[model samples]
Target: MSAATSRPRLVVGITGASGAIYGVRLLDRARALGVETHLVVTSAGVLNVHHEMGLGRAELEARADHHHSPGEVGACIASGSFSTEAMVIAPCSMKTLAAVAHGFGDNLLSRAADVTLKERRRLVLMVRETPFNLAHLRNMVAATEMGAIVFPPLPAFYHRPQSIDELVDETVERVLQISGIGQASPKAWAGL
Candidate 1:
């Protein structure tokens, strides 16, 4: 069956990274496209949303089709058999990135990510830290070697984004495009 005939399920993990809006916008796009989303957020993720996006917990949770607690290790998405198309940790904190790299699943978000990797499913981690130390670089390499896509939400200036929202939407669109679920809002380059 085609994608339209079957509902695509995506597990979204939001961490204590600086770009909480990336996660929120991903949810909005997924919802708009009729995709099923399972959301899990670390405590710091919620705090980041309040600080960065000025959104409350209820408001953030309201965007997703389902919400899973970070501490809820037994959540359905934590199992390999749950069958999600992809798991994206938008604005993934370095702490969580390290955990996933070292095979540490101390919470629901990491556990779900671990399950995604072990299941050979697409696991996209938008690691959101800069000025990388050797350790951070190594962790990113390790995660990549283990099948997780270490995507940093870098702004593409070629899009000539007029506002922060445009930048965010383009980044979210690019990430979701990996799962064939969202539109590419940025103008494409026809030739180099």
Candidate 2:
């Protein structure tokens, strides 16, 4: 539909979580769909991305139309008026999750996510932690109750992916659906 071609604006937040590839995959999918993406990476997030995806700053930034520093408040995505369609904190650190859940907008990543919730736009937090304690669950619940989506980096075995990329693509495709792209960008699951 031409209406969907209006291009959704995405705010991607990369935290210091273990699985950084999710954020990269999200950016690539958005770019491929001609969606405008605003990328903001925390210091730990940068290290995680290089460790997981071997993507340098330039290469990663190239995947998005606009890139901002985690500390940069002037970034267009920091304001509630910026009109972002959604914000996804892929590989979202538990620290970041706790911060946003408690209204602690210390940096651009948290601030952007806060703005996303305030604007009633989609806010998907890919909580990248394992063995979640009660505290972590509480934080996630608080975020979800406040209109944020807490998607864990859990891979589904139903797809029977042959490689890591396929598994990654399947999860990333599901996340993309949250942004309104659905399976049209990545191969959709049509029942094998």
Which candidate number maximizes lDDT? Answer: 1
lDDT of 2 by residue, 39-138 (tens): 9999898888888788888888898889999879778788876776788899899999999999898888898888888888889999988899999999
The list of candidate 2 runs beyond 4 A from truth reads 1-5, 182-192
Off by over 4 Å in 1: 1-5, 182-186
User: In terms of TM-score, how similar is model 1 to the real structure?
Assistant: 0.94
Q: Candidate 2 local accuracy as lDDT?
A: 0.85
lDDT against the true structure, per candidate, is: 0.89, 0.85
Backbone collisions counted per model: 0, 0
- Candidate 1 residue 49 C-alpha distance from true site, Å: 0.4
- The alpha-carbon RMSD values of the candidates against the true structure, listed in the order shown, are 2.1, 2.6
Model 2 weakest lDDT span, ten residues long: 180-189
